[model samples]
Target: MQCPRCHNLMVEQSFEDLRDDTGSLCFKGWRCITCGEVLDPLILSNRAAHREPMSGRARQKRSFIQIGS
Candidate 1:
């Protein structure tokens, strides 16, 4: 994904918890490498459901969520 603010290429990266949260999701986030914009993979998964399933991406996304929970 490209950064909305700066039109920079985004990269996938992971981060460990910096602060304690009792019940927060602890997954890593995708961010713009140059502009520092955050992207939510979960939101992408939800949006993918609206499109026609031509590839395995949507199915894979659904399976990932089910496995996560």
Candidate 2:
């Protein structure tokens, strides 16, 4: 899969959610190799529901802090 944020190669990875209320302990998601962005099924669905149309103007990319830096 391709990462939506960086247009890089994404690999499927398994993640463990210990405190999930849905009772599912493990789930699969895609992780971007370049930008370290993660996308799961729930997150994709939420974004789709609240997605807005893109404007003609270009937007600047915001810098993000790496968790384990």
Candidate 3:
């Protein structure tokens, strides 16, 4: 299969925790050889849901620590 994003040839790969979700399932997926993109049933679901990527703000609100002397 070809990657939708990169248009590169995809190879079959297997891994656990398909999309970083709290599930105990191992899945078979396709990975882009050029862009390192992963495409699987689980990943596709999350992508379709349009959930925010797991970067930048992991939490909804800002967190900080105060420094004192």
lDDT score, candidate 2, position 4: 89
Clashing pairs in 2: none
Candidate 2 C-alpha error for residue 6, in Å: 1.2
Q: Write the per-residue lDDT of candidate 1 for residues 1-69, one digit (tens) a residue.
A: 677789989887775454566655567668888968777766568767776666778788999999999
Tens digits of per-residue lDDT for model 3 on 1-69?
Answer: 989988989999987773556757788899999999888887788878986766655543334322221
Report lDDT (CA) for all predictions.
Answer: 0.75, 0.80, 0.78
Off by over 4 Å in 2: 20-24, 52-69
Q: For each candidate, C-alpha RMSD in Å?
A: 12.0, 7.3, 8.0
Q: Write the per-residue lDDT of candidate 2 for residues 1-69, one digit (tens) a residue.
A: 999888999999998887757675888999998999999988989988976655422222222234334
Worst 10 residues of 3 by lDDT: 60-69
Q: Which ranges in model 1 have alpha carbons more than 4 Å from their true place?
A: 18-25, 41-69
* RMSD to native, candidate 2: 7.3
Error of 3 at 22 (Å): 9.6
For model 3 the TM-score comes to 0.52
Cand. 1 Cα-lDDT: 0.75
